[model samples]
Target: MRYSPVLDRLAGLGGAKWELHVRARERIAAGEDVVDLTIGNPDVPAPADLVEAAVAAMRAGRTQYSDGRGEHNLRESLAARYAARLGRPVHPNQVLCFPGTQTALYAVLMGIAEPGCEILVGDPMYATYEGVIAASGARVVPVPLRAENGFRLSAQDLAERIGPRTRAILLNTPHNPTGAVLTAGDIDAIGRLAVEHDLWIISDEVYEELVFDGVTFVSPLARTGFADRVVVVASISKSHAAPGFRSGWCVGSREFADRLLALSETMLFGNQPFIADMTAQAVSRPSEAARGMRARFAARARYLADLLTQQTALGVHRPEAGMFALVDVRSSGLSDRDFALGLLDAGVAVMPGSAFGETLGGWVRVALTVDDDRFRTASGRMVAHSLSLSGQRAEA
Candidate 1:
């Protein structure tokens, strides 16, 4: 059988991290003890109230399909919350709901990008974005985010990469893999560049609520003139520990939202109404669940960062936001893939940085979603491996 030629572009989609995750899970299933930190699957349970709300919704016969756009209540609830956060008026007409943020991101890219057009992405971006962009018939132009710059993407970098065929800029705040949160000033500069270039801004703020150490999340929509041009994609998976619910949203201009809804209609008849109800409850009600999750993740992040920094030769950066840290393994004298496989052999699993971007070949990303004890054990093993590598180098 033959497949479409376009499918060929998805050749290296999941990359090394996903492959390691599969291998680690296989080993664990075969009775091997492995501390897996390769994926950001939250170990924490969802809030009790959220679970109850879903049950209530199901009992109330919300199993039927909602409007293709989303349930009215959920959309309004999300709009109000975003309005409060952005300090501006965000109407329900400007919001589109999807079963997952990943799907929402794909919809936005498909809506905005044309075949052969370019989408500017920062290096060390979310792994899924690459495949999604390629599938959308768009090319990804990655701007390197150097460790010396604290892995921050600068306006000058964006300016240098913008070309005539550039149609959009995908920005991830509290960025995955690196946990680098963009400041308000950084957002302002990038917004100006997007506006100047007449490019659409697809801001992936999935980790907006996972910031650590008192760092505030600044949405691109909050910038002065870019509100009309930016589409903010976020999810309850990270914030509410409800990945199974698969609820997420896109906020943008009314026209953009309408277009996305039309695309979503063609893709999915509609999202699950009961899940939408549960998501509505999660976002509308003022609960301390998300705050508690953030605090717990922050503590775990700090613990792991301190352990890696003190006990290993690897360079560790304590992330300011999000639930992962980037550790440099260049001193180990191995590529990121080899280093990750070695850790897996040591009974631990972590993502090789090369999976995120070509420029991050000497790094590895460790998740903070695991329990304290497991994370500590994994950190110890990594430290021991690093020491052995150092010893071998010294002897040679």
Candidate 2:
């Protein structure tokens, strides 16, 4: 029996990057005392109000089918919330709800890109990005996000890479792995390039609400004159600590959403109504849970960065937002994967930055989502590993 060509390429696509993380888990399951800091599961629970709202909606029978654009009330809530944030009016028609950001991205990619086209994504991007672009029959062309630039995607780099075959620019701010937040200037400059090229701008803002103090997140959707070109997908997963709900929505021009409606209807035909209702409530007001996460993540990142810097050859690149921190393992003279494997022996499991993209070959990412005690213990192990590497360097 034969399968689709897409599945042939996507067979556990990007799964190889997690081999060390998987091995670490296997060791722990075998009763070994390994500290796994690999994935970013929100340390906090879903807010009580949002959870209660979901229960009430379920009991009231919100389990029925909804249109691809999702419940009108939920769309309305999203529109209003975005309107406030963008300081512009937004119609409910501009919002399309989906199961998660991942689905929204796939649908958006399918809607905009096709075979032989190119999507310009930053290097060291989210791991799943390539798979989605591949599934869309579009090729991903990586534009390196230099460490010197704090890993923020630059308009100059995009300008250098834009070509006739380039159909879209995928933007992820408050980015994963590196946790670099794109400033308003960054968006303004990048949006102008999108306009010049007449290319679509697919913005993944799932981590928008997770920005740390002293950093402001700018979305292409907020840029003037690029409304039609900018489509943003965000969710309550990180903001409200409701990843299990699978509730997310896309915000684009009314025209884009209208066209995407057909594709979405064919895809999942909207998310769970109960989850949408819960998210409607979640986005209508401020998120105290997110606020706490910001503080906690910031503190943990700083502590780990300082600890590793002071005690070993490792250099930590403190994040501007999100729940993961990157440690530069180049000084240890090991590839990121090898360093992660060695760290596994040290009783800590972290993600190799190379799993994200080529530019992160010398870095490893650790989650700040772990409890403080575990994170601290993991930090100590990393320090010991770093010291050992330094000792080897001295001997050499």
Candidate 3:
């Protein structure tokens, strides 16, 4: 049996994170008390209004196939939202809705990048980006987002990595795994570089509404001079706690938006009409769902960060925003993978930092999607595991 070489390439991507998640789930199903925290799947209930909107849409006979560019009303709502958020005029024709941000990302990568091209992504990025880039026949060039620098991409690093082969830069704010939000200065630097090198910017603002504390999110599209080249992708999945809705959209220049719509037509025809209508309802209505979710997540993150800091010797970097934090487990004298497995045995599950990128070998990502009680239990178990490992090292 043979497969395309692309399949072989994807096989090496994702870095075994899924395998760990599956193992933890099997343990739980076998009656083991596993405190799984590997994935960022939100456990919060979907907004009642949004759920009702979906039901009403179905009742109103919106289940039919939609136009290849998504429902016109939904696209218009997204354009208006972006216009208010970015302070720039975004037309309905410049918005392309998709089933998920991942799908939108793939479409943008495939549309803008050709074979043998390069896409620059920050290190410690979401693993799915690498898989999508590989599937598009383009290589991923990682720009290291070092822990010493708070896991933020530096302008100098970006400039050094850009070459004739570099066609796009994928930016994730309130970044996954590390929870590092890009500062305003960072956005400015990146926008300037994109214009200088004539590269497309695929800004994943999925976590745009999940910022913690008093921090404000600055989108790449808000940066001047790169409006024509920046494709902003976002969803209600994180912001509205409706991942099952599979609703997201891509906003860019009118020309680029049409390319995304064309690619979407051949790939998915269009997003589910009912889902689009439901998403439009969520976007149009005034609601505090995002604020409530952000507050809950911030509390969970702070509780876990304090526990890790006080109960263990591990170096903890508290997240500025988002629903996850990174802990430096190198002090345990174990690889990040081994440390995570050890924690699983101790009854808690986490993702090894290496799953994000090779440069993150000494860390582990702890998600705050669990409830307060579960998170407290998991934090205690993780602390105990760290202490046990420290004792063993002392004996050696």
**TM-score winner among the candidates?**
2
Can you give the lDDT of residue 254 in candidate 3?
91
| Winner by lDDT | 2
**Residue-level lDDT tens digits of model 1 in 1-396:** 999856898885766448888999999999999998888876688888899999999999999978888888899899999889888888988988887899889888889987899999999889998988998889999999888878888889889999999999999998988988888888899989888989999999988877775787888888757788999999899888888889998999988887777788998866788888998888886546567767877787777778878877788877887778888999899999899999899999988898899878999998888887888898889999889888989999
Q: Which of 2 and 3 is the better model by TM-score?
A: 2
The lDDT of model 3 is 0.86
What are the per-residue Cα lDDT tens digits for candidate 2 across 244-292? Answer: 8888889999899999899999988888888888888889997899999
TM-score of 3: 0.97
Candidates' C-alpha lDDT: 0.86, 0.90, 0.86
**TM-score quality measure for candidate 2:** 0.98
Q: Model 2 clash pairs?
A: none
For model 2 the local lDDT of residue 15 reads: 82
What does the lDDT come to for candidate 2? Answer: 0.90
Residue-level lDDT of model 3, residues 130-174, one tens digit each, is 899998899999999988899988889989999999999999998
Steric overlap count per candidate: 1, 0, 0
